[model samples]
Target: MSLFTRLATSYFFYFAILGLISPYLSVFLDGKGFTSVELGEIFAILTATKIVAPSLWAILADKTGQKLLIIRLGALLALLSFIVLFWLNSYWPISFCLALFSLFWTAILPQLEVFTLTSVRHSSKIYARIRLWGSLGFIVLAVVAGQVMEYYAPGNLLNSEANLFTNAFVWMGTVILLCLLISTMVIKPQRIVNKPQQQALAITGKLLDLRFIIFFMAGVLLQISFGPYYGFFALFLRDLAYPGVAVGLLISLGVVAEILIFIFASSFFKAFTLKAILIVSLAATALRWFIVALYAESIWLLALTQLIHAASFALFHSASMIFISEHFTRCQQSRGQAVYLGGVYGVGGAIGAYIAGVLWLDGLGASTTFLTASVSAFIAALLMLFWPKTIKKPSQ
Candidate 1:
């Protein structure tokens, strides 16, 4: 396959599986008789592995100059580990399977980011164009899963919960297998030129810059605020009387906006400072969550809220990618991406998922959980207001 095709397809399948899990997995777990607290613990297990796995794999990939090899190995092992989910029907066993699966899965994306940026010579716009395919794949599977669940797992159907979730699990696994197949087809990544290693102190000193710390801390807050949505949005909709297909469409609406944002992300970057874009996205995220908290049962309000995902995720992510690309050196690129993943998606995700579980129980409820998320996003925006208007690019 051509380099462009390989890069785009990698994003497509990687997130296709993510689409299966992120929006539907809670419902699947609920169907299997797990409580909200158990779901939170299980999801935390899945995300917490991300904290260490990416960095460990990145160190090996950087030292060996074999990023594609690492990607391939991660994909293969992740697929193998995930296969155990089919046989493990209980809490600890399934959690163990998910933890193993996540360990391998976390190894793929950071290295892939370095490879894609290197392939395209670090044009952030081109990376967005390629990455948008992942959004497209996500939309497709989310809608399909919704429709399948509606047909087989409708509230009125006999044993619909089991039927609905079983099929969803099957499809989620199928997407992972597709990811593995595509991993085999992608063009191999070129080796990065390794540089003399920096001392631990020097590397630590560089990352300790005030701007860098504030930027990533804000990102952590943003992810933390997404806890309820990521962990329970589908279930929230279902409880509000929406069918499975409608729930899928609701989820897809956000990605649809995300896709549009990515198509024009390069233009936005060229036109605005990263800080400005980040502020707008963060502020909008706060608004989005507030609206969801207040009006989740209102289709119109939810649809309007979903459109803000373009700002919340797509624009915010584009700005952060540019920040990482400019701030870190080529040799440190994989690890920098690893830090972003580990910090924002890893640690942040774990905190959010677990907390959302706690807040999702009786008395507090989903709306209150989302209200807390909105407060968190607003705090993140307040932090972003202090970001430096300009950053000095580090020399590798």
Candidate 2:
């Protein structure tokens, strides 16, 4: 494969599995008789492993100068760990399986980011173009998986062949196998590895910079607010009487919006400062969650909210990726991505998943949870008003 195809393939299947789990995991768990709190706890367990795993794997990759090897290992192990979920019927076993899956899964993305940016020499247009294929992957699976689940949903667990094909765990494991197959073919970028021994103080200084600190905090808040949506959005839709296919379409609508933003992301980066893009995205996140809280039962209103995902996720992520690339020097790239991913996504996701669980109250507190999400995102936007001047627009 060409470099673009290789990176695109890596991202595509990585998030294809993500597309499966993110919108539908709770629905799958609910089908098995888990409570809202338990759902939250399971999601929390899944995210909590991300907290330390990425950083550790990054250290090894940096020290050994073997990032692609680590990516392959993580993919293979993650697939193996996830397959165990098929046999486990109870809560703890399921949680443990998810935790193991996540631990290895965390190792793939941070390292992949370092590899891609180095290979492309940090071109925003190319990176966004490649990354959007992942969104395409996500949209494809989100719709197909939803349709499959709707058509062949589990009943009489062991008796029916239809349920066997429709089962969430089965779908997730199959996607991971695809990822593992693709991992073998991608060309490893030439020598993007960090020599951490000499750069510890430099990395520490970058991490301690007030701009990166505030930036990281803003990201954490955004992810924390995502807890309700990520943990329970499909289940929430189910409560409002939307069928499986409609639920899939609604989720795909958000990714469709995300893809459009990515396609035009370079123009936005050139025209505006990173701070402006981030603040707008955060504000949109606030608006999106509020609309969901107030009008989830209204299909048109819900579709409007999904459209806002362009600003909320795609724009914000494009800006943040540029920020990280510029903020850290090349030597700091590996750990820098690890720290950002671990602290922002890892820790933030855990808190959000757990809190969403607590707030759900078996779906009775759904509005309250979304309202809380809006407030959190609004606050995150407020923090970016003071982003350092050094954080300027990207070059391309």
Candidate 3:
């Protein structure tokens, strides 16, 4: 197959596994008899690994000029390490497995994103088109996995025997990650033109510039607002008495909206400034959280909230990717992507997941937790709105 096809396929499988993990992992842990605090801590541990893993591999890939090799190794090792989950039944052991699993798993994506940007020569439209495949993969697997879990799990999913269905999710995720490795292997490495290396001090200075700092700070808050949904949306729906199929559809609905936005992301980039997209996405995210918090029992309102995901995730993610590609120098591309992933998705996500867990366990409940998420998203929007413009003109 062609390089573009391989790249798209790699995304497809990689996100397929993520689709399983993001929406279902909490349900799996809950079924495994984990207390809410323990669940929060474990998810925090999983996300925290991303803090070091992506940047470490990114630095290695940059210095060694082995981007594809690093991608392959990460995918392979993550799959191998994740296999230990099938037998381990306790919190500490599973937490250990998750830490290793996420360390390598997180290493793959940031480097792959850098590689993709390099290959496409910063074509925003093409990148979005390729990324939409990941959304498709996510939709298919999320619906199917939900059905699979429902089939294998006994009633209420709390029984000792019922929890075994969660193992199916682990196995499915392992196979998908392995498939991603194979896709990476088949991808012909592009000839990356190495830019002249800048001094470490200069690189650090640019990375710590005012604009860069504010942009990442906004990104961190945005991801933080996603904590409750990512860590416990499935459980939330289940508690509200929604069937597994409906829960899967609710989760898939957001990704479905993501797919639509990605198909036209280039047009958005052309019509609006990056700041506009970020503001709109953050604002919509805030609104979405409030809607979810207040009207979760109203399936129609929840579906409407899912549609806002088009703005919250797809547009936001596309804007951020382009922003990173344009702002950072060629030599700093991998590290720039790593910083975004590690800071926003890693540190931000860890804090969000853990706090959401605590809030759900100790506070009024899920609704109150989601209300807090809304406030966080609104603050992120304000940050983006006031950020100093560093680019003179739009790149699209």
Candidate that scores best on TM-score = 3
Tell me the TM-score of each prediction against the true structure: 0.94, 0.95, 0.96
* lDDT per model vs. reference: 0.83, 0.86, 0.86
Q: What TM-score does candidate 3 reach? A: 0.96
Output the lDDT of residue 318, model 1. Answer: 79
Task: Report the C-alpha lDDT of model 1 over 260-325, residue by residue, as the tens digit.
Answer: 999988888777788889999999999999999988878999999999999999999878888888
By TM-score, is 1 or 2 better?
Answer: 2
Error of 3 at 50 (Å): 1.5
Candidate 2: tens digits of C-alpha lDDT, residues 283-336: 999999999999998999999999999999999998888999999877777788
Extract clashing residue pairs from model 2: none
Full-model lDDT, candidate 3: 0.86
Worst 10 residues of 1 by lDDT: 197-206
